[model samples]
Target: MILLRNLVFALFFGIGSVVIVGLAPVSALFGQRAMIRHATAWTRFHHQLVRWVLGIRVAVEGERPSGPALYAAKHQAMWETLELQMRLDGAAMVLKRELADIPVWGWAALRYGAIPVDREASAAALRQMIKDARRARAQGRSVLIFPEGTRVAPGETPPLKPGFAGLYGALDMPCVPVATDSGRCWPRKGLKRPGVITLRYGAAVPPGLPRRDAEALIHAGINALERRA
Candidate 1:
């Protein structure tokens, strides 16, 4: 039954995604705001599918960050990636270079204002990310980044990527560290299970702390829920 539900959800989800991406040209004709609206609608479609077909739901804890701030979230599954954007009411997502290279979808993401970083480029990538992030900030958008760089299992706690610190320091924005149990319901691979995925937003870490201090606070904050379990 779960398998059948997942298959159905995947089919609808895939079709919806293709349709949204297919309309990118039209959305682009209207400008970047239109493209972002299209992207948000696509995310809503995904959420509905997750709820109606997969029987999964999200429960957010604590106050959602407002205004221009840095959202540093734990990486567990693809679920939080979309959810965070919606909850933040449209943020400038910092993503990997490879994801931004995926033909039409990638082009649409760039049009919608995602900042892509090339991990292999190290220092250069950090510089480029800060530059892009500054542009996003100037445009009055909060920046959302998964500091861990890649998704991990529910219990795994990995050190954040160096780029996170660089961006944090450069952006000079208060950081909201978000923790989630998304992996419990949505695994990186295999069928997603039906359950409540709790997103717990920690207190905002003030900007301008030393790099080591900021990283430590963010690491502990994002792993707070996991640590208790």
Candidate 2:
């Protein structure tokens, strides 16, 4: 039954992507704001699908930040990626260069202000990412990134990737760390289960701390839920 539900959800998700990408040019014509709205709508659709079809409920704790800031979130499953966009009202997402290179979808993502990082390029990519992130901030959008760089299992907590610190120092914005238990319900490579996925927003770490301090704070913050579990 879970398999069937997942299949149905995937089908609709694909259709939704095609429809949104197909309309990207129209949204782009109006400008970036319109494109962002279009992307937000797509994320909202994912929320709806999760609720009605997958029987999963998302519970968010603590207040979402209102102003432009950097959101460093736990990377457990793909679920939070879509949810963060909806929750942040289309904050600029930091994603892989390959994902941002995908044909029409990539074009739409760029229009929606996604910052793509070439993980293998190290220093050069970090510079480019910071530049793109600042551009997004100037546009009044928060930047969302998974500091760990890849999804982990429910109980695993990995050290954040080095680029996170570089971006944090360069952006000089309040870093809001988010914790989640989505991996328990939504596995990285398996049928998603029906359960509650909680997202807990931690206190914002102030800008300009030493790299060690910032990384320590964010690492603990984003792993809060896991620690409790």
Number of the top lDDT candidate: 2
What are the Cα lDDT values of the candidates? 0.90, 0.91
Off by over 4 Å in 2: none
Quote the lDDT for 28 in model 2: 96
Question: Per-residue lDDT tens digits of candidate 1, residues 28-122?
Answer: 88987888788889888888899989999888888865678999999898988887777787799999999999999999999999999997748
- Clash-forming residue pairs, model 2: none
Model 2 lDDT tens row, 1-229: 9999899999999998889789999999999999989988888999999999899998889876678899999989999999999998788999999998899989889988999998695788999999999999888889999999989998899999988998899888999999999999999888998999999999999999999999999999999998767
Give me candidate 2's TM-score against the actual structure.
0.97
In candidate 2 the C-alpha lDDT for residue 99 amounts to 94
Identify the runs in model 1 with alpha carbons over 4 angstroms from their true place.
none
Q: TM-scores across all candidates? A: 0.97, 0.97
